[model samples]
Target: MELKKSTQKRHQLLNAALDVFCLYGFTGASLDDIAKRSDMHKSNIFYYFSNKEALYIEVLTSVLQKWLESMQMLNVDEDPEEMLTKYIESKLEFSRLNPKASKLFALEIIQGAPYIQTILKGSIKKHFRGKVKVIAQWQTQGKIAADISPELFIMNLWSITQSYADFETQFEVLIGKTLRNRSFYQTAMKNNLQLLLHGALVK
Candidate 1:
């Protein structure tokens, strides 16, 4: 029963950490907030993690792992268009299903990630470069537009797609409806996805 209690406590801490970090950001959030959210004591948080920064990193790592897992679910070959289409869908789906994680990630990145900058520039860089290289390979093989720079194209694509998740509140307030529920928005997504795959790459 001791081990069971330990496991439960660990899970509880993780869940609480996610909520606090997502809502308050790493710097904005306090250990008190995590403890209250998790229904555990601040001292207990220390028992599991050395500091708030460490716990925040763990939460970010967990969120990153889930995003990477989503990427791993699809084959990145055979049909570049379909492959990329599904990939975008997966990312959007994750945003809808895991908005808090998205917000946390966006917040960390927006602040320059003082605590996690090294990890972002290191392992995360390698991971992103790997994917970018794949897109470059596709461009070289005529699978994507030969004219578009893989890096710029990807940056734009991500910016456009993640806009819904990152700026939904503002976007919705302006449009008076959610981007997720609109047909025009859906078609726009389909069109933009195709725009990258269509003439941008070939005749």
Candidate 2:
């Protein structure tokens, strides 16, 4: 009862922090901004997070953890084609639903991931290596192109999927339309996914 309410309020604060951080980046965003956005006193914000950096890290990790979970969905037991299709679909959906999170993550990476470097070097790197191994296994089994480099394959996939989210404004301007509200985004991803699959599979 009491604990549940407290947890909910803390989650709310974290979400508010995410919005502020995404808009202003880590160095630009302040706890005062987060407090204003959350409609809470500055002291209340501090009660939830010891400092602005701590709040930003939590928000970033929350988004990154969701991404890692999506990646983990690509189990080795699944058919490579089906797994890849699902992975692209999931990433596209995540971008659509959480564009701000995507942009925030891109900002962090572009800035060299200063705050999250430890996590990136540790758990995130370990998890990514595991997935790369899975892809290597698939390649050996002739599930994908034998000549493809697993690292490059994953990097390309990340770039393609994340671009739709991180570059939404530029894309909308170029395409003369907004994907934020349209089913066209999903359609586009599916078409691209098919092209990738065709290229990766052995004839």
Candidate 3:
């Protein structure tokens, strides 16, 4: 289905905002930059979003929403090992395709997430709590390691998957090659992540 004109415009602004925020951090990113990237007039941006902060929050929410959707792919009824491996694959794929979103999110958290603080404390917290419940249930069913803390376990997964996007430059420089290399990603990143997750979680 085609998006409404307004919705398409909003998406354009949001995507541009994501790129700007990823490149320039919260304090440095400007409405002008977002406007230029969106190819919309600055006033048009304000028409869609009340202010820069509002636009920033919306971008953060959009990115976080995507992250949550990836996690939502997990099914408690499925074999836990398969579910976990699929989850890691989905996350890494998202990072590969949308590194800008990951960078924008990392910048927000690193700067203490001022604009997104309310969201972090509210919906984001609730989402993680629900996932934690699922993980705990899996542990009780002997599907996952009972010895691991669900919160830290999830954190570890995020760290590993997000690092691929967030630290792409470091990896490229260290390995003397871009992550665009399929074989390298399979051997050095994705496969290793799946192996480690299965090793740690499967019971």
Cα lDDT listed for each candidate: 0.76, 0.86, 0.82
Model 3, TM vs. native: 0.91
Q: Report the alpha-carbon TM-score of model 2 versus the true structure.
A: 0.95
Each prediction's TM-score against the native?
0.84, 0.95, 0.91
- How would you encode candidate 2's per-residue C-alpha lDDT over 1-203 as one tens digit per residue? 99998898888898888899999999999888888888888999777778888888999999989989989877778898888888988887888888899999999999999999999999899989999998998888888898988888888888888888899998888986545757777677867697667788775
- Mind giving the per-residue lDDT tens digits that candidate 3 earns over 143-179? 8888889898888888888887898899888886544
Off by over 4 Å in 3: 1-3
Indicate which candidate wins on TM-score: 2
Alpha carbon lDDT of residue 160, candidate 3?
83
Model 3 worst lDDT window (10 residues): 187-196
Off by over 4 Å in 1: 1-5, 73-77, 179-192, 195-203
lDDT of 1 by residue, 14-106 (tens): 888888887878778899988988888889888889998888888888888776675553344656777777777777667666777778888
**Top-lDDT structure, candidate number:** 2
lDDT score of residue 202 within candidate 2: 73
- The superposed Cα distance between candidate 3 and the true structure at residue 20, in angstroms, equals 1.3
